[model samples]
Target: MLGKGIIKGMAETARNFLGSYVSAERLTTVQYPEQRIPQIEKARQFPFLVFDGDDPMKGLRCVACQICEKECPPKCIYIVKSKDKRVDYKGQMQLYPATFDIDLSVCMSCQICVEVCPFESIKMDTAYELSTTDRFGGLMVNKHQLAKSNEHYRHIHPTDAAASDAALAVEVAKAQAKAKADIEAKAKAAAEAKAKAAVITPVAPKPVAAT
Candidate 1:
């Protein structure tokens, strides 16, 4: 009975060994550089910054609040607030990161940065081809290198991207409605004041003449 189990294992191994030659699926190795497996949507390798529009720097959603950098488990993320402020996607003036760097060598790809980020600026990238000869320089990725378009995020993670977009749309709509209400309230108050002034009678002219 003991030897029967060993025999069964050997038989299975032999089957796989021989089947590899006849079946493409059974092949242990794939042709590198020319052929590759499709990347899974949830497969994450490293963290990358996501930008909305064509301009990577201008369209970046990160306000450099340092939430992600502070929360990073490995403490790989480093960020510096910009000296000048710029408008964000929500049209609110915000501080961008003048210096954003990630030491990929120390990065554990825990995705903690993505979770802590309020702006949805950072997300996990599926790319695993980070081999480098110049260990320090190559591994230390800057903001320019980490920045990717929102379209790319959609391409890689369609489901998450859709949800994120829907949430953002709702937020924007609420903000716009609030702004409109505030403007209308101000205008209405001004109009009411002007009408009240026009209706008031000028009785001071007779009194001044008596004086």
Candidate 2:
């Protein structure tokens, strides 16, 4: 009986061994360089900011909100706010960001910054081919490195980028329209005040004329 158990175990082991080779025939193992797996639609890889191409300044969507910098766990985001010389809807100068930076080495790729950004300025990119001899030089991406035109953003993420562009266009148009309306309102108020002042009421003749 003891020898019978041993024989059955050996048979099971032999079956398993043969099964490995049998399954290998149907296996779909792709060789590196020869084959590639496509990424999923919602994949997030690296951090990047979107910029508007039509604007001569290549204006970035980021308003220097500092939300990304604050939310970043590694404190990798750095930004410098530049005083906007131009007037806004209220004829008041607005302050925007001048510089932005992100240290990729410190970034954990958690996408917190991207998620928390209200302006949709920052996002995660699909590019993961980052390899360099010098970590410091390669990892520390400045405004120049992080900046990409809206066209580029659309190219990388067509569906999402198109939506974002549409939203941004609406916002920009609204802001411009509000500015125009405010100016017109102010001008109209001034004109009304001038008209009221110009309309001098007729004064009654003095009592001496009756005498």
Candidate 3:
């Protein structure tokens, strides 16, 4: 009975060794660069900017609010507001970023930037392959390199993208409704003004006839 514990450990090891060949759950090793496992939906690496349309510069959702830059734990994000203001996707006037940069070398991927962004322009990316040879410039990702399409966002984070789209739709509907109400109110005011003018001028003709 002295060697009984060792015998049981050996048996367990043999069982696992056999299970690795037979059981799908036990087969964990994958061929790197050839066969890759499906990426987890919630897994995230660095952050990327989300753009709406085909043109990354024109369609970028970032209004350069600087909230993300201010809130970044590592201070990896940098933004410069454009000299000329531009309209955003919601047709609201806002200042776009003239330059945006993220230092990947210092970035901790804490997702704080994405969380603090008010414009929903930034999101955590699933891409992890960021190996580089050049130490000076390769790690510094600029706006052009950071910008990614909304379609790509949907592809990577479908649930988050759908929720964002829904929220945007709600905002657009509210803006349209407010505009319609303003137009109706103006028309009503004009009609009232015209009616008042007609009513007040009518007595002049009657007075002339009486004379």
Q: Top lDDT: which candidate number?
A: 3
* Candidate 3 lowest-lDDT run of ten: 202-211
Please state the error at residue 182 of candidate 1 in Å: 1.5
Residue lDDT tens for model 1, 1-211? 5699899999999999889889988776779899898877899999889999899988888899999989998899999999999988777789999999999899998999998887788998898999999987999999999999999999989999998889889878888888889899889989888777666646334345556
Off by over 4 Å in 3: 1-27, 186-211
> What lDDT does candidate 1 reach at residue 61?
85
Candidate RMSDs in Å, in order, are 3.3, 6.1, 4.4
Between prediction 2 and prediction 3, which has the larger lDDT? Answer: 3
Ordered from best to worst TM-score, the candidate numbers read 1, 3, 2
Give me the runs in candidate 2 sitting further than 4 Å from their true place.
Answer: 1-29, 54-57, 83-96, 201-211
Q: Rank candidates by lDDT, best first.
A: 3, 1, 2
Pick out the ten consecutive residues of candidate 1 with the lowest summed lDDT. Answer: 201-210
* Best-fitting candidate, scored by TM-score: 1
| Prediction 2 TM-score vs. true | 0.73
Q: For model 3, how big is the CA root-mean-square deviation?
A: 4.4
TM-score of each: 0.84, 0.73, 0.80
